[model samples]
Target: MTDYRAAVQDMNFLLHDVFQVSQDWATMPELAEMMDADTARAILDEAAKLTETLIAPNARQADEQGISFKDGEVTTPDGYKEQFAQLAQGGWVGVTANPEFGGMGLPKTLSAQYEEMMCAADISFSLYSGLTAGAIMTLDLHASQELKETYLPRMAAGEWTGTMCLTEPHCGTDLGILRTKAEPQADGSFALTGTKIFITGGEHDLVDNIVHLVLAKLPDAPAGTKGISLFLVPKFLVNEDGSLGERNPVVAGSVEHKMGIHASATCVLNFDGAKGWLVGEPNRGLAAMFTMMNYERLGVGIQGLGAAARSYGTALEYALDRRQGRGAKATQEPQAEADPLIVHGDIRRMLLTMKAFVEGGRAFSTYVGQQLDRAKYAATEQDRADAEALVQLLTPVAKAFMTDTGLEATIAGQQILGGHGYVREWGQEQWVRDCRIAQIYEGTNGIQALDLLGRKVAGSRGELLKPLLREMTEFLQADAGQWSAEYQQLADAVKSLTEVTEAVLAQVPSDENIINSVAVEYLNLVGYVVYGYLWLRIARVAEAQDALGEFASSKVKTAKFYFAKLLPRIHSLRPSIEAGSKELFSHELNEF
Candidate 1:
């Protein structure tokens, strides 16, 4: 297996050339003061060093050793403790946390690059800090001043860790039906009692305490999702002086044995009358949790991107080094018995397919990060609102579509290795397994599709999508020059997306089940269109570079590959989306 290398060069290209985030930051005073262009580049360089030297070398060993759960305590792999401590000491746990609360307070655009590097190095290692970051964001936004002061600093400083406990054994997507109970106390706290399955970082020994942001029901609260409220339950209680107190009843019943990411602990937590505090207002818990969930959804998308990026690097190395068959035209190495895998047409296809998806997804993820920065720090309310709308419209696609293609890219990478990929020694199989879970967790790809088509699009009466459509249309209306053909193809794709959306929304009135039936296809269509738009932007930026170096030239080539080959996937998805629910409803469940 090839050592994991951070795509620092590509990341710099996106930050400086493609997005020009420094310019965007200058418009927002808060962001402008945060850091300059040199500082951002320097930070990325440092992160690249840390991930490559420290985190990545432990990934294979961690996977082979897994986690050791004994009695009630869970222990990670051999070097995890020391590595995590180093990560925390470097203040990486709060790379994007509030500086006022011991966090670095960096913008998402910059931190996002750091995130991708971490995930590529070791996704299992990244989760402990990633969940902590998410929990810190939620507390910063919604927690009371006292709670924020108590928890955020500790979490940000890496003295403690956090987890989101939303899924029960019986409920995953349907949060309204969860049976967790939160009883109010005279001391103004709540007593949480329930079981939350599939909680990441629930019982890890990397931190002193685990802060769980739980979803439960209050006694007088209304029924369904409206009644849900968010709570903060800790594994070990904290005293008034910020010292560790008695242990709370929140315990991990067992850690799940999973197919991949063996280094990360997936626990089934039991809250047996655990002491807790309210996060947001009563009956508004879902809203508060969403602050974390949205951040995580985007983070999960990056997880897929990270896996794909790593897999691509490994595959590319193998393709260049592993000699297979002769080239179609002639043997490049006349003295050699055979040629490298890169000389074969099918192998080149697989490598380019992986490259196209990985690079395009990276660009898309960074763009989403820019929108997030705008949503937070933009000068005007209208700009912030516009950024927020785009975030809403694209969050589902970022999570679902990225993971779908991420899995595809990983598999293609694995296939490039043939028999070697199936065995553990090559490490390609592990990536394939790990990438698969990204599509299933956070929310299944199917559920993400439903959210994109049903809630964000049809539920909003297409208001949320209009902002993105307009943005893409405006880009197409701009000057293209030599890239006119690619721009036109993207324009056609955008048109197809708009038409398909309108057609689906039109059918929703008469065919109530249409959204559920055609949602996955519609989401893919939207994904391909959005990707096509991003590819155009990438190609344009690469072409406009003063010195079209290897990196810039490759970007242009990859963008061309995406348009010529992958972007047309929208065509097949469009017909499936337009077909409505009739064929789906025609079959009975037991027919098979």
Candidate 2:
């Protein structure tokens, strides 16, 4: 794990040379001063140092010791507190938060790398800040000015942490059946009473004050999701002059004993006549919470990517160090006793598979992060709208595809280590366990797939996908002559995916279950096509750096491997998607 690097070089390559985000940022009034390549690289380098040296070392301690829950209080492992304070003092907690509220005010394009590095260093410790960042962003967008003035400064500064309370004991994805009740007081605040479960960072010793963004229903509210409302419920009530008052009626009912991420507290929070304030208009709580959930979705996707990246580093190390097998075509050896595991073809295959997906995902996530930045800071209305559309279209893909592939990469890494990976000390199993939750929480991969197919694609009738599809087409049309063959292969896949998308759309309205039936396959097809385009981009850049010799050559080789081996999975997925839901529902519930 110590050998693991955060892929800062590739992140910089994507942001500065490939995407030219500096140019985009320079044009925007808000980001001009801090948008240069040097600043971005410097920030990434600093983040790498912080995570690698300070934060990463604490990960094993946190996982092994786990957090303690006694009397509604959760205490992190020994080193967790000091490292967390360092993280907050560095202002990394609010790297992309609002400038007016003491945040760093950086672009998501840059901060996304920070989030990735932090997660790679220590995900358990990182969640506390990650959820806080998401909450601050939501408050900035939807909270009233008074609320923002009071809450944003402390939260953005990391003095007060935040959590999102959306799940209930019975209601998970189906928020329409939630039973949380909110009664309005004469002071214009609401008295919220509900028990929210699976709330991450719900109660902790890291901060004295914890702010919860809870979703509850008003008395006269409408039925279903529309009736739900977002509220800002603090652990301790804030005084008029912005001081901490008496403790509110919010407490952690219990902490969940989980298979992984033991250092992070997952609590069942009980709100007993708790004081809270409305975030947005009534009956639109779902929409307001999306402002936070959408941010967390990408953040969660990066967590998966980080897990894969770290696992790949650890597995590669094991393969290089462990001596057993000989090369397939070895005629001679310096030491005739044995050779390293890397000599075997099968091991090389596993390593390459991990390499291809992790690198491809790096490109994809950064591309999505750039879109997030443009959506927020691009100069024109249409530019902003286009970026926003692409953001909506790809958010679910980033969340689902990355986590799905990430889980695969981790398991492959575990297999690479054989018996040692199964043991606790080797830490490969921990990577697998920690990463498993990302796919399940923050919306399951299945749910994300449905969102991609239903809401983002078919619901918009492919209109939402046009901006991204057009970007791929225009890039192929561009003068990327040196990598013509690979680019052309990606071009063909893009065209095929476009046709499949149209076919899926046509079948969705006619068959009610079409989107649910083909959602996972459709998302995978889109992911492969997306990764193909990104691989070509990476290859073109690698080719320009032939002077660097092996490093650049490896990049080109990985691109070829990805296109040749991994991209074809999309072809198999297409037939299943087109085959529709008839076979899926063919068997009755009693038949099983």
Candidate 3:
């Protein structure tokens, strides 16, 4: 397996040239105080070196050895402990946590790049720190002052890890059916009694304690999801001096045997009258949990992007170095009797396709991160509200589209290697396996599409989507000197998406199941257009840079491929979405 190299140049291009975070930072005091352009680049460079050298090489071995479960205890593969220690010592877990509580407090736009690098290096390892970061964010946002003082610094310092426990044996998506119960005690705490499954980082030896943010209901509370509340349940109780006390009743019943991410623990945790403190107001836990969910959803999407990026790098290297069939043109390797795989048109197509999606996705992720920054640090309430609206509108697309296409990109990378890709030795197969879960987890791509079409778009009567279209339209109307034709095509795409969104809205009044049936297709249409917008932006920046040289030239070519080849995918999805749910419900229940 080839060593995974982070796309630092592309990251810098998106940060400094495309999104221009430096100027944005100047407006927001929180970000301005953190770092400048050079500082941010140094962080990315350092993260790339750390993950590539220390973590990437150990991924395959860890995946092979996997996690071990014995006597309700879970242990990671060899070398993970030392690697996790390094991650903690570097304060990577709390990169975006509150700086007042011993965190770095960098912007998500910067931390997100580090996330991509870590995931590319090894997703299984990335989850341990990623989940911790998400949990830290949730705690900071919703937890009380005492809880924050007790746990935030320790978690930020990497002395402990965290998990989000929301699933059960009977419930996966519908939290309304969850059977967990929380009983109030005399000590002003709640004793939570429940069994939660599919809890990542639930039980692991990498840290001394696990902070589980769980959801349950009180006895007299209203039924269904409305009654649920969030709890801060620690594995061991904390004393007055902020030291670990007696063990809580929560224990790992068992660890799951999974398809991928073997090095990360997926446990079935049993909380038997576990003493916990309420994090927020009762019966509104789902709202608070979304704080973490939204962040993790984006993180999961980056996981797919990271794996796909690594796949492209590995496949591209193999194509260049490995000798293959003769080219259509005269062979450069006449003495060697065969040409490299790069000479083949199909291989180039595959390689370019991977490049198009990976680079476009990177830019899109950064764009979303910029929105997050605005949502947090923008001066005025209206500015923050507008940014938050965009974040809500595009997050589903980011999670679903990136992962859905991310899986496709990984498969294409695997296909480039043929039989060698099917085997584990090259690590392409692991990427395919690992990337598969991104679409399923983090509120499944299908659910994301429904949220996009049914909730965010139709729920707001198309208001949520208007801001993004306006942004794109403004960009297209601007002076993009040499890229007029490409901008026009993007204009056409935006026009098509606008029409499709309106059509869906018009049909939803009569077609009850319309959104569910065509939701994925609609989301795909939006994704392609969004990527097209970002690609053109990247290409425009690349072309204007006199110093970028070949890097700039490659960006222009990839943007062309995206416009000429991939962006046209929307042409097909548009009609599918327009077809409505009629054909889907045409068949009878017994027809199959």
Candidate 4:
């Protein structure tokens, strides 16, 4: 496994050079002085130490030991309980949480970089804390002041963990069919009864208590999604004196036997008349859950980027160290059995592809993080709205594209190691397995595509597309540099994407099934073009940096590779998106 030092440096580059997040952090008076470059760097260094020394060292062992579920109690692997305690005591859980509730109150952009580092180090271990952060955000935004005061501080301090209970056995994407029932009682509380499957961190021994943000339907509420309401159901009810009371009705029915992320317990939760309190207004649980889901969607994207970084690091090491066939143009005789794998152009191609995608995804994640900050802390309403709109539009793309790239990058990395990559000891195969879930869990990439094409782009008659296109056009027009063939290629790719978007919009509504049929392809097209734009941005920055002269040269070369090898996918998508829905719908259910 790769250490966290390199990951932190990459994160700093994305934050300071690629995104210029300091300026955005300065906008919020609360965060202006607390998150300077020095503080940020120090935070990164500490996180690296904690991740490399404490969390990452146990990654493989935990995966082997897995979480044990016996007699309704979940026991984490050895050392996890203590490490999780240190994680909470260190205040890492509250990096981006509100200050009013005993949190560090850092900006989202900085926290995003931290998240990437953590995920790269050990994704399974990180999920235990990540879910708490997501649940805290939802509670802070929608839960009552009493709930916030009681739970946020404890959650931030790591005394308790939190889980989002939305996916039942029958309902995942279509939350409209969720059967959880919430009946009001005389004491301003409700009894929640339902089973939530695949709930990450739902049952863990790392915390003293677990808080569940459950979605259930209320009696007399409207039907479908509108009838859903969010509730805070704790594992053990807390007494007024901050002591633990009797255990609530919520119990872990069983822990799942998953393909990866074995350390993080994915529980089947049975909320059998669990005592609960509504977080927000009735019939608006989905709206509140969206707040958490959107944040998590972006976090999942970071997971993809982090996994890519790990894959790249390991593969790069192998390529440089492992001896293989001689170079294509070897001028000198080989001294050893063979040459380093890096000598091969094909190997270089794979490495550079991984590098390009990882770096581009990093930049994109930071960009979205900055947008989230602006949405939350901008002084003007219009600025906030604009930032929020961008966040909404790009969230799905970030989730789908980053993970798709992650899976591809990890596979490429594993290929670099050949047969050694498939084994368990090297950890290469584990990266591939752990990363696979990022695409599937956080609203499958297919669903993300549907949301982007069906809801985001065409939702408002291309209103979102117009602003994004204008922004890209302005950026390309502003970079008036000479002797930059890669920049020109990127500009062409952007123009191609614009035309494709317009064509898709024109054909989508006329044939209602077109969007669903080609949503994945359209997403890939947009992803490639957007990444091309990121490569261009990175090249421009590298051009001006003297400290990283050699690195800048590599960036230029990698950007060229991206344009030449990767961006052509955008053109491939045009016909696919225009193919109409017939191909997908052509097969009848009985044909199988």
Predicted structure with the largest lDDT when compared to the true one: 3
lDDT of 4 by residue, 173-224 (tens): 9999999999999999999999999999998888789999999999887888
* Candidate 4 off by > 4 Å: 1-4, 331-333
Error of 2 at 478 (Å): 3.5
Candidate 4 global lDDT: 0.86
- Ranked candidates, highest lDDT first: 3, 1, 2, 4
Candidate 3 contains a number of clashing pairs equal to 0
| 39 Cα displacement, candidate 3 (Å) | 0.9
For all predicted structures, in order, the TM-scores are 0.99, 0.98, 0.99, 0.97
RMSD of 4: 1.5
**Residue pairs whose backbone atoms clash in candidate 4:** none
lDDT of each: 0.91, 0.89, 0.92, 0.86
Question: Could you tell me which residue pairs clash in candidate 1?
Answer: none
Off by more than 4 A, model 3: 589-592
The C-alpha stretches of model 2 lying farther than 4 A from their native spots are: 331-334, 479-482
Model 2 vs. true fold: TM: 0.98
* Residue 383 miss distance in model 1 (angstroms): 0.5
Query: What tens digits encode model 2's per-residue C-alpha lDDT throughout 1-592?
Result: 4455778877887887677889988988999986688988899999999998898877887899998999999998998878878888999888878989999998888888888888777789889999999999999999999999999999988899999999999999999999999999999999999899999999989888999999999999999998999999999999999999999999999999998899999999999999999998898989999988877999999988898889899999999888885676653266567788888888888999999988888888889988988898889999999889989989999999998999899999999999988987778898899999999998899999999989888888888888788988998987867667777788888888888888877776679988898899989998989998888888888788767588779888999899888998887998998899999888787853
Q: Judged by lDDT against the true structure, how good is candidate 3?
A: 0.92
